[model samples]
Target: MIVLDYPYVSRFLTDSVLELGQAVLDTPQARRLAGDAPLHYIDEIEFSARLALGGKVYTNSENGLGHVLRCRCNEDLARQIDICKDKALFRESVAALHPDYRFRRVPFEDLAGLDAPDVDYPFIIKPTRGFFSLGVHVVNTPADWPAAVRAIEAERAALNAEYPEAVVSGGEFIIEQSIDGEEYAIDVYFDAEGNPVITNILHHTFLSADDVSDRLYYTSARIIETWLLPFTDYLRDVARECGFRDFVSHIEVRVTETGDIIPIEANPLRLAGWCVADITALAWGFNPYECYFKELRPDWDAILTENQGMATAMVIGDLPSSLDRTRIRDVDYEGFQSLFANILELRKIDYHQYPVFAFAFVSLPETELPALKQTVSQDFTRFVVTE
Candidate 1:
């Protein structure tokens, strides 16, 4: 069973639904986003019935989490969602895995009052429940604390109005010590027996330590060959500790210098947002949706051998916060694509309603990794036309 919610959906997903014959929960939002596509639509009753029967559940956006909660299908399903969505709870559940990791949850009202001397230097502060990296800031020193608080305050109202509190809330914020290492975002689902089945792994690249934007995520045969086994082992530990089964999650983690995989957080019931999961299809020759629904695990050994030198990436064209979205006239998508070497697909988004201009899936030579990094730091304002 799948629940589609606001923001965006993709042609790849709809095609997957048609191909897999997956039942989408019939909601107005789903109908509108999905259009008149001949998808198998199920009513609320059937949705709940299927869920109660222990059918697999997946949601494209956390906004649809409310519908999943209301269905009350499986107790563990609800529990798993709660634990994954709440950063504090998620930290506690997996504390045994990283006993030395430091973290604390502070109410939004008290964020400004936190004693600077008491906090560990250079920690990350973000909404307890957040999506898309909004309100995420790295406080390197006491002087940076005020700026982080003000930034959160500035975005609070817009955040509340733009996203449901379930998807993103400013009620509470989490302060945790930053993990130092290479970061990666993974898409995986646990089977009925709580064994994790890995689907795709993308290396998340950032220009600087303090940069927190959905700028670039790329994967290659080398990445999969290197981290697939270790990440699967890490997920198994997470599943065992959290009692997760028949659950799908898009998880972010950091691999330390010592080769330890420390989880950042898990976005429940989906791969990447705005159908970035399609990067899997662009990179590999399979649909991630089909992989999950049919429990079709990738033959990693064969896959790695076949695609040894190629790399795939999802590059987000996010509008800078300084730009006034309402005044934007148009985006020169062609101008932006000129920056990349090869674009597999260019998904243009309505920046007037959303902050992003588009999501580009690109195929590049693994040797051109530095070019991908350079593309992330380019001044995207040149591509926008403002009144």
Candidate 2:
């Protein structure tokens, strides 16, 4: 039984989410992630749209979140790839791939003491199982640890309120000396034959030098075409080195000034929600979801043969919760359009009161990119809400 994690689906790009559901319909022996023998919800609109699109409704039920692998992957493969979810394990696994790729990790328990000291300036502390950048902090100096820990404590409480089922254990964390550089993410797909394909490389935007909150990410088809082949080849090596096969993953990396790619975080079975994977569709013609099941293994030869041009997907980060827990009350809309004129679609996922992420998809010519990046970061509320 396939069980689409819910209320969870409500948290993503609905267009791409529906495309994913359609892929399930295309896959043989697949069913919705929420049914029990022909009765399951398709969230917002499985009944109407399914009927309109001539989609099938499968009601076979599956219980327990542990069965998530049954939704689209084999059990062994899922477990193998999931280890990367633990940020600590992820660092070891990636560093194992090559000595040059290095990340220092320390348990949070080690830092809880008052006397143990002298950590370098500009370090990061994040939950071992963090999501959406919650409980992530930057320690700019020795004096910042107290406030940083307090912030993590507050974030832990807010996260517990948002997701009670999966609590963040305070015992473990990966504290790393921060690295400098522009950050990026690569969406990976393995063909049914185990060949890894780098479908998209996202250019990320941050609020400031110490800002760990994930703000914006964008990628274009034309940009992907210009990337060096060795980068993808290196990713394939990382996959093989880590013992992952036949999987979909979003690998986060930092590109240093010298242009070396450094892999930092790994999320298995697709990019983090909000349909970041849909950028693949915005980049190439097919959304990553449709490509995954409909093709099972993507047909890169045919896709590249089409020689698609410029297109981009933008994912804007949610406003960070205030210390007082305030809601967003304002947005700079005119500033947004003026800064990024190529926006095709722009909207907030949740209202200012609810405070979720916002996104846009567009295709801007190369000439405007430098200004786009600088202006967007400088004007924080231009496209997103501010608390």
- Steric clash pairs (candidate 1): none
Off by over 4 Å in 1: none
Candidate 1 on 134-177: residue-level lDDT in tens?
A: 88889899888888888888988877666799989999988999
TM-score of 1: 0.98
Model 1 Cα displacement at 7 (Å)?
Answer: 1.2
- lDDT of candidate 2 over 1-387, digit per residue (tens): 122432233223334445454423222222332233333234323333443442322111111123343343344554554566677787777675646543455565565564423455677778776656767788888777888776665655555455332324444677776777877787766654556777667777776788776666766545566553656777777767677765666778777778766777777665545455655665666655555444444566676656554546474635546512254555555555555667766655543333454566666765566666665565344345446
Worst 10 residues of 1 by lDDT: 111-120
lDDT of each: 0.89, 0.56
Model 1, 366: alpha-carbon shift in Å?
0.6
